[model samples]
Target: MLDLVSRPAPWHQPIWQQLTAQQDFAHAYLFSGQPGGGKRRFASAFAAFLMCDAPEHGFACDQCRSCHLRLAGSHPDLLLLEPEEEGKAIRVDAVRQLVDFISQTAQQGGRKVVVLQPAEAMNVNAANALLKSLEEPSAQTYLLLISDQPSRLLPTVRSRCRVQPLGLPAGTEALAWLTEQGGERSREECALLLQMAGGAPLLALTLAQQDALAQREKVVEGIKALLKGQVAPSRLAEQWNAVPIELLLDWFCAWTLDLLKLQQGAVEHATSADMEKVLGYMAQKLEVQRLLAWQDWLLEHRRLFASKANLNRVLFLEKALVQWKNLLQRR
Candidate 1:
C-alpha cells in the first residue's frame, strides 16, 4: 500500500507549494511519468492535501478528522481504482462502479477524491465509461489519474484533465536522495543503480532491493558470449528464465538507442560502461537500415510486453537473441 500521508518527494516540493496555494482546483488531474518517478506518491500527497480540513505549510495536517480517516484506510469519500491483478486491463465494470461512486453525496460532507493509478490500464470500454465522469464532474470533487504511459490513454480522456508531467530530477539531487535511502550502499553503487533506473531515485532504490545488479551482470555476460559465438541463443534464453522480461527489454532498448547514437557519430563513446565495447563494435559493423529494422522489431515486442500478451518466454528470448546476433552478420 502507498504511504498516503507522507510528504512529496524532494524534487516535487516546489510543485506541492504551487498546488496547495491554489484558490481553486481542477476537477480532474493527470499525473504522468516513467515508472518509479514519484508520480504515485505525488498524487497521494496531493489527494491528502486536497481532502484535509486543515492544511499547514502546503501539506496535510495529519491531526484532522479527514486525515485520521484517510490514514486508517477508511475514508468514505476517497475511492481508489486499480486493476484487480497487476498488468491486467481495468475492466468496464470497474469504471461503472466509479461512476456510481461519483453519483453519491460525500459521506464525510467534504470534497470527494478518486485516485486511479496506471490509468493507461483502462481498456477502451473502461476509458469510454470514464469519459462521462470526466465530462460531468460533481461539485467539490477531484479525480486524479496516474499513468506511466500517458500516450496510451485516449485523446478525449487526456484532453479533459490538467496534465502534470513528473520527469527525472537533477542528477545530483537524485543521487543524494538515493544515497540516503540506500543505507549501507556505497555512493558508487547508488550511482550505478540511479543510472540503471534512468535517474529516477525511487526506481533506483527499488532496483537495489531487487538485486538487479547481479541480474544485469548475467545478461551482459550472456550478450558478450552470444556475440562471440561461445553460447547458443536457445541456451542463453534458458539461462535467463529467472530474469524479468520487462527489465531485459528496457536494457536492450537503451542499448539500441545507444547504438544509433554511436553509428551517427553523435557520441564518441557509449553511455553505459558495461556494454561500451560491444555497442562500439556493433555500431561499426551494423548498417543504418538494419539497425533501424531491429529497433522497429524490438519496440513492437516491447508494446506486447506492456500489454501483457501471453508469450512463450523461451521462444521470445531465443528469437530476440537470434535477431540481435544477426545484426553483426554481413548483408
Candidate 2:
C-alpha cells in the first residue's frame, strides 16, 4: 500500500477520457513513455478509479471507502511492484509474490490492481515468471506496467499488454505547468530546465527544485578544467562520485551533442548556452566524427548505468574522462 493521490495532471485529461470511456479494459496495460512523462501517475489514478465503490466522470470518488483506503495507503487490493532499491533489478522472488497476490481474492470485493513501475527493471527470470500471469490474467485483476524503456522488456511480455505510448506536453504547456509547480523560476530558467529535461514538465520542475543548473555548471567547469590539463581524471571522478551517475552521463551526453551541433553550425538548436564557451572550445579542438563517437559512447554508458551493471563508478568515470582528455591531444 502506497499513499498516492489520484490527481491527474492537465496533460493527462485526454488520455484519461479515452481510457475511462471504455467499458472493458485489457488485463494488462503497458504505459510506455520517456522518464517523467507521468505514466506512473496515470496508472495510479486509474487503479484508484477501478477500485472505487463509486467512480464519477472517469475518476475515483474521493469520498468512497476504497478511495479512502487508497488515500490512507491501506488499499487491500492495490499492489505496487518495483525494484527493492533504486537501480536494482526486480527479482524473481518479487514476481513470485505478485503471482501469489494475484491468486488471492480481492479484499475489497472489487478489482485488484498491480502497478509495476519501470517494468524493464525486472530481471529475466522475474519477467519470465510474470508472463504466465499476463497471458492468462484472473478476472477483475488489472496489471499496469509502466516503463521508461519498453524495449528492454522481453518480446513475449511486450506482446501481451496493450501498449499505450505517452508523449511529452507541448513546450508552452510544459513551461506553464513547470512555472506553476516550481513557483520561483523565471520563464527563461523554466525554459532551460524544460530543455534540459527534454520538455518533460515534471522533470523540469524537479530540476528547478533541485538547482540542477548549478550542478550542471560544476560539471561543465570540470570538463573545461580537464581539457586545460588542470585536473586528473581520477580526481574529477572522485569529485563527481557523489552525483547520480545516470544524471552525470546524461549531462555529458548533452554536452557532447551540443559540441557536435556547434561544429556543424547548429548553435541555435544547442541546449546549453551556459556552456557555450566550453562547447565552442571543444568544437574547435575535437573533430566532428570524434565528437559523434563520444556521444555514442555516452549513450551506451547511460544505458549500462540505467540497467545497474556492476561497473566501478569511479573507475568508469575515470576512463571516460581520460578518453575525453586524450581527444584534446589528438590532431
Candidate 3:
C-alpha cells in the first residue's frame, strides 16, 4: 500500500478536505489531472477519511482499526481498482468485480468506497458497466474515479459525477515540496520537467526520475548522432521503437519542435541549457526550409500520438530522421 505523499500538489488539503466535510453528498466523484498530480492521492486520503473512525485534518488516524485495515488493503469497505497491466484499459470485468463487491454491502459497517485510478482507461463496455452502477448507486457506496484524460471519457460518465480538475503549481512550490522530500534537482531540470509534465510536478518528478526521461535523453542523443552523421538513422528509430510506444511519439514531437526552433534561430525558446550546442550544430548544418518541413512531420506525429494511429509512428520517425540527415548533409 503506497501511502499518499500528497506533494507536488497538495490537493488533499484544499479539495479533499471539503469533499470529506460534506456530511451528506452524492457518492460519485471524478478526480481529473495529469498523472502523479495527486488525484489518486487525494482519493486515497478521502477514502481513509471515509473509513476512519477518527479523522484529523481530513486524514485517517493510523491508530484506528479502519486506518489499519485500509493500510492492509483489507478495509472491506474500500476497493481500489486500477489496471493490472500498464497502458492497458480497465476491462469490464474489473468494473463488474466492483459491482459485485458493492452489491455485497459494507463489510466493516462503514461507508463503501470504490476508487478507480485512471478512470479513462475503462473501455466502452467497462465504462457502461460502471455507468450502470453510478446510475443506481447503492446506499453508502461511493465512487471515486481519477483520470488524467477526462475528455476522453463519455459525457454521460463525466456528467454523472462531480469533476475535480487539478493542475500543477508553480515550479518554486513544487521544488520546495520535492526538497522537503530529500530529493535533489536543479531548477533548469525542474523547469524542463515541469513543462514536459504539462504543469504537473508529481508527473515531472515521476517521469524525470523514472526510465522515461533517461530514454528520452538517449533518443535525443541518437538524434544528435544522426545530425552529426555518426549514427545510422535506422538505429535511432529502432531505439524509439524500443521505448514506450505511447509516450515515444509525444516526446519525439517535442524534440523535433526544439530542433525546429533551433534551426530558425529561436534560441530564446530553447528548452535545455545544453540547447546552445545542439541548436548551433543544427543551425549550422540544416537549412531553414528543412527545419520548417520537419515541423510538418511533428504535426503529423502529434496527430498520431493523439489518435488511434499505429505502426506508422516508427516509420514516420525513420523517414523524418533520414530527411533530417539528408538535409544536414546537403548543408
Best by TM-score: 1
Each model's TM-score, in the order given?
0.92, 0.90, 0.81
Give me the displacement of residue 8 in model 1, in angstroms. 1.2
Candidate 3: clashing residue pairs, number: 0
lDDT of 1 by residue, 1-331 (tens): 5456558898988887887788999999999998888989999998998889998888899999999999999999999999999998999999999999999999999999999988999999999999999999999989999999899999999999999998879999999898888368888788878888998888889999988888988999999999999999999999998888988998999999999999999999998778999999999998889999999999999999887888888999999999999999988
Task: Mark the 10 consecutive residues where model 3 has the least summed lDDT.
Answer: 2-11
Taking every candidate in turn, the Cα RMSD to the unseen true structure, in Å, is 1.9, 2.4, 3.7
List pairs with backbone clashes in candidate 3.
none
Judged by lDDT relative to the true structure, which candidate is superior, 1 or 2?
Answer: 1
Positional deviation of 307 in candidate 2, in angstroms?
Answer: 3.2
Write out the backbone clash pairs for model 1: none
- For model 2, what is the alpha-carbon lDDT of residue 86? 86
Computed on alpha carbons, the lDDT of every model, listed in order, comes to 0.91, 0.84, 0.72
Q: Tell me the tens digit of each residue's lDDT in model 3 across 1-331.
A: 3354322246346665566678796879898877767777777776677677877765677768878877776777878788887667899989999999889968778888888877888999999998888899899888988888899899999999988786656667876665454446666566666666766667777776675656767776886788777888777777777676556556655656776677666765556444447765666677777677777866766676655546565676687778767766564
Q: Which runs of model 3 end up more than 4 angstroms from their true locations?
A: 1-8, 211-217, 237-248, 259-267, 280-320, 326-331
Error of 3 at 112 (Å): 0.4
Ranking by TM-score: 1, 2, 3
TM-score of candidate 3 to 2 decimals: 0.81
